[model samples]
Target: MLRYLRQIEVIGVENQKKLSNSSVLVIGAGGLGSAVITYLACAGVGKIGVSDGDLVEIHNLDRQFIHAGKIGIKKSKSAEMFIKTLNPEVEIEIYDDFGKDKSLRISKYDLVVCCVDTIEDRHKINEVCFKNKKPMIHAAISGFEGELAVFDFRNSGSPCYECIYPRNIHSEKNSVVSPIAGIVGSMQALEAIKLICNFETLNHLLRMDFRYMEFIKISISKRKDCPVCSKNL
Candidate 1:
């Protein structure tokens, strides 16, 4: 409690306890994952699973701070080292290989944070989370813009990632202003904490343009024909 004394004052002791017992799986160790993992570990999430098969590269340092000085190593392993050093009390798990076949692994966590870079990866994660009926926090960054949304599949009526973006859309590597990743990633972590503590979370897609300091919240509904979520419905 001492470690989270200030936070407990805001969320209460019971909520703090909920956080300590919660498990979160972060599916990327890149830019967004770095911030998401850092704050979640700092907030005392009991277990964190990091899944990223990519290796650290020098170009990643501008945003992926967790991999500092660990270039050439596996990102999941680098993330584990960062979490252990930041909060030894938190349990850490690393997955060097993540794909569509890891649905069982997704079922083991209380929440899933989708911080991956590609639209395809997001679809894969969305499918698994929707199938398992788990809450998923998703965020994406490009240039000075980012978007966030929570698909709480625990509720039958909640919208999902594919509900907003169809699977037919493809993603290409985009340039990003580093701070945008931090801004959106931190919000993802906050959403996860709020969900674990039974607080009201964002029920709409939040789009931000940091360059202009603009923020927009758009209402989202389940797509009647969404391939991933509609089938379950």
Candidate 2:
């Protein structure tokens, strides 16, 4: 604790302890996941669970920083090895599969970070978190564009990912550059750190258009028919 006291003092021991006691589930091991997990461990989040069914591809070297030089490795194992070298204080668990509600009993974690690229899994995680009343940090990137949002389902009036991105709208292919994924992934990590450290973080949908270096944020409204968070709210 003393070694990390400089950081713990600002975040506070209580919050630090809270972070140490908390575990976060990262649903991807690609670009966004690489940056998200790297910082979470650095901040001393006690346990991090990573789930990804993909193996490292050579093309991932551009931005999937965690799996560098370890292409062809399983994502979970790759991420575990990455963290083991970064911070021994942070424990990592691996799930070598996609994180569906049926496959993952997410209640095991204090929070969930959805960094997966697919809208299908995005909806799955959204529904599961809302049902279990877990705090979720969500992010997506395509091309030079990115979007981020946070949903604390247990918090009154907090909008969910589905509130902004209804299923049909998000059905488009999510094409993204490796750096774009890293940028969004890092933002996801920042959100998680803020949540765990009791630091103030964004609660609304944030959109970034790197093509013009423009950023716009709009409050996420809860839809009355939001299947994911309406009833839970």
Candidate 3:
């Protein structure tokens, strides 16, 4: 109850207890992933699971704040080390693999935060979450831009990730500026916490342009033909 300084009286004591009992799985440890992981740890989200095959590189320091001075280390391990210091009361889990390998298995978590960079993994997480009937907090970043969306398959008509990206359009690698990932990744953590804490979220997509200092939301509707959500529909 004392761990959540911000939520203490605003959400009351019982809600804080709920937060302490929840588990979340975050699927990246890069720039955006770094932000999501840090806040969730600090927020005292119990039993967090983080996965990333990336090793910290010199270039990641700009926004991957949790791994500063720990370059060349596996991101998941490095993140886990920092999380230990932030809040020991909460248990942390780490993984160094791709998100798609066992999407359904990973979806067993209470909620999923998609901080991984690639669209394929996002699509995969969306599929598994839909199949497993879990909620997904989706986030992505490139250059000075970023986007975030949430699809709680537990709810009817919630849009999946594929409702936003086409298969042909998402085949290539993406370009990312350090802070863009931070901005979007932080939002991912925010959404996940909101869901865990049972607070209202935008529940759609939010796009940000750091260069112009603007943020906007694009309404998303479930696709009846989306291969992932079609069965559930």
Go through the candidates in order and give each one's C-alpha lDDT: 0.92, 0.84, 0.80
- Candidates 1 and 2: which is better by TM-score? 1
Please give the TM-score that candidate 2 achieves against the real structure.
0.92
Backbone atom clashes (below 3 Å) for every candidate? 0, 0, 0
Worst 10 residues of 2 by lDDT: 97-106
Report the C-alpha lDDT of model 2 over 29-139, residue by residue, as the tens digit. 888899999988888889999989899998778888899888888988999999999999998889887545443468888888988877888898888888788888998
TM match of model 1 to true structure:
0.97
Q: Model 2: which residue pairs collide? A: none
RMSD, one per candidate, in order: 1.1, 2.0, 2.0
TM-score for each model? 0.97, 0.92, 0.92
lDDT of 3 by residue, 120-189 (tens): 7777777778877788888777777878888887886787888777566765446777767777777788
Residue 73, candidate 3: C-alpha displacement in angstroms? 1.7
User: Which pairs of residues collide in model 3?
Assistant: none
Which portions of model 1 miss their true places by more than 4 Å? none
Order of candidate numbers by lDDT, starting with the best: 1, 2, 3
For candidate 1, list the clashing residue pairs, or say none.
none
Best by TM-score: 1
